[model samples]
Target: MHSDRGGQYCGNVYRQLLHDHQTVRSQSRRGDCYDNAQAESLWSRLKTEVLEVRERPVFADLADAQRSVADYFDYYNHERRHSRIDYQTMYHSHQQLTTLSTLNCPA
Candidate 1:
């Protein structure tokens, strides 16, 4: 389900795209910003932790910045620990998924 309060979601083009995919679109009530807190919080953390102190980039520099951000994301997923996620990196979460699957499989 795609969740957003953007006006583009209400347009015929977007609705048509969803219909083609047989997807359901869920929208929060208008003027309600807190409904998308998870997404907004992520953006806030990304900006404050990764982008806010960085030097502004020119058009050509954008590619380099994007590459750096991608690299950071890899490190973030594999190295950084999160308190809310039991102090484990996102990589640990994937390991848990596979471990459970292996243990549950029939011999």
Candidate 2:
């Protein structure tokens, strides 16, 4: 639901898809570049890892591209170690947070 104020996000096709799913639309305040930094960073990494290394970044088909991107994200979330979180894997961090939250809840 969170995105920059891009034209496509405000367009009918995208709005309709969100409406159909009953999701709220949220956008960053105009002119706030920092609000989108995380997404931009991810895009930069994806392009560098999968697209920019090759001369022709085009895939044989759309599904191939989707699969490649999905695989990259899966690896990023489940396997890649992040120095920001004491070099822990993202999956472990998420599990720890989940366990902490569950323990904090009343029986």
Candidate 3:
């Protein structure tokens, strides 16, 4: 439910739909650019990297679109870098978890 403070993003119909599904709405604070900056960054990356690819961005089937989105999510979680986490990709963080555990182990 986290989104920018835009009227069209969670307009009346969308709000009603969420209400029907019993979901809470959360929005960024007004006039604060960084409040929901992470969500904005993810959306920008999805559109630019997944939807606007060079080999034409139209999907002829629902499964294709779903697969494409899934692939992007996998890449985002595994390969993408985040500065907040010392510029380490998520894949590396998970890998380093076992490394740290092994170092701390007695045997």
Candidate 4:
């Protein structure tokens, strides 16, 4: 996973976990603060579009919160148009990429 220079991510336990799972660890170069800009922007949009638009603005429980977030993600990938991807839904863009990759794959 990708993260900034944090003590929790640097510990031996976290490193061992990643190694055990064969997951590549990505970290920002020292003194580079904008590594998480994309993630931060996504979170800002989620908060604004999902949580802030709710009537109560709070979930009744953990399950409720999870379901709400899951629904939001479904809408985000399927229905929402993003300017970054030429105003196409994430799901559509993913489908196009998958099709292109499959066509380009060599036997």
- Per-candidate TM-score against the hidden true structure: 0.61, 0.78, 0.71, 0.71
RMSD list, candidates in order: 4.2, 2.3, 5.0, 3.1
Instruction: Show how many residue pairs clash in every candidate, following the order shown.
Output: 0, 0, 0, 0
What do the candidate models score in CA lDDT, each in turn?
0.79, 0.88, 0.83, 0.90
Candidate 2: RMSD over Cα atoms? 2.3
How close to the true structure is residue 33 of candidate 4, measured as C-alpha lDDT?
74
What is the TM-score ranking, best to worst? 2, 4, 3, 1
Error of 2 at 86 (Å): 1.2
* Model 4 residue 27 CA deviation in Å: 3.3
The candidate scoring highest on TM-score is: 2
Model 3 residue runs over 4 Å out of place are: 91-107
Ranking by lDDT: 4, 2, 3, 1
- Whichever of 1 and 4 has more TM-score, that candidate is 4
lDDT-wise, the better of 2 and 4 is 4
Higher-TM-score candidate of 2 and 4: 2
Write the residue-wise lDDT of candidate 3 on 6-76 in tens digits: 88766899889889999898888889999977677888999998777746547868999899889888988
Better of 1 and 3 by TM-score: 3
Q: What TM-score does candidate 4 reach?
A: 0.71
